[model samples]
Target: MTVLLTVLAGLGLGLSLIVAIGAQNAFVLRQGLRGEHVGLVVAVCAATDVTLIFAGTAGVGVVLERAPVVVDVVRWAGAAFLAGYAVLAARRALHPGALRAGTEGARVPAARVLTAVLALSWLNPHVYLDTVLLLGSVAGSHGGDRWWFALGAALGSITWFTLLGVGARWLRPFFARPAAWRLLDAGVAVVMATLAVLLVLRPV
Candidate 1:
């Protein structure tokens, strides 16, 4: 019963953090709508979150909490990755046919999609704070049953991403036009760039 309660608490916290509209979610939705590797994208996001949550529950998060230099390194790397992705997104927007052509020709390479998803999920400071620090701290409060809390948090991530990807895919027909794709890509580019700037400016 204690574990169940802890799981519920973790679920609530994880959902609260993830449900917000952010660069990560925006990118996922855009990719899903584009009929990209939606399942792979969702799986990567969920798996990354679960892994971090597990680490946090296992007390690795506490070690990271005390390592200022490590945190700084992660922050900078994440910012650089996001910035690079933003540039790619902008270029895609400008060219217009690149993404569509890629989608048409070769199914957008599973490895490339997985790498992008990993970068988006693992490289973000917000993800660390939300899944590793914040959720981990909350789970740690459960004493020996912290794993239950981590399980709950993992469930939240899985549920949310699955829903987002599946739901967005259902809207594919509505957003099938070239102009719509261009608008979505442009929006993704702006959000990703803004997130990169914010991450860079954040105090280490």
Candidate 2:
């Protein structure tokens, strides 16, 4: 029962941190909506989260916490990437005719999608802060049960990404319209831009 509670705590905290609107989640949603390489994208995200969580649990967090420069570098790179993606999204939103619903759009290369998702996953400093530092700190509080907490966090990440990628298909009908694509892109643009700015201004 004690182990279960620790796991639950980790799971809940993991979900709370990851479920928010962010560059990674936004990109995942867009990929899911396009029905293109959703599995690959989801796998990359979940795997990255699991890897980071475990790394943190393994005491990597202590090393990273002491080196603020590493976080700053990631922050700047993430900001640049987000800003560029936001521009692309804004352009897409402006040209609704170029947009297509479901699998109707021009096929993007899987390699390109892979690169984008990886950039989003690895470049974001917030991931290091939340998944590494915060989660690691909390897991340490559990003492010998820290691994259980890490496992639960990993499970939360796997569950969330699987549901997000697989469940996005249900919204295909709604996204069938050009207007919906525009709205979605517009939202993505705004979100990406906002996050980019925040990443630039916010200290970790």
Best by TM-score: 2
Clashing pairs in 1: none
Runs in model 2 with CA error above 4 Å? 100-103
User: Model 1, 21-118: lDDT tens per residue?
Assistant: 77679868977776788888888888888999998777777787788788777788888887887787777778867857633456677788888888
Per-residue CA lDDT of candidate 2, range 71-177, in tens? 89999999999999999888888875555422365789999999999999999998988888889989998999999999999999999998888888899899988
Off by over 4 Å in 1: 102-105
Clashes of each: 0, 0
Instruction: Estimate every model's Cα lDDT from 0 to 1.
Output: 0.81, 0.89
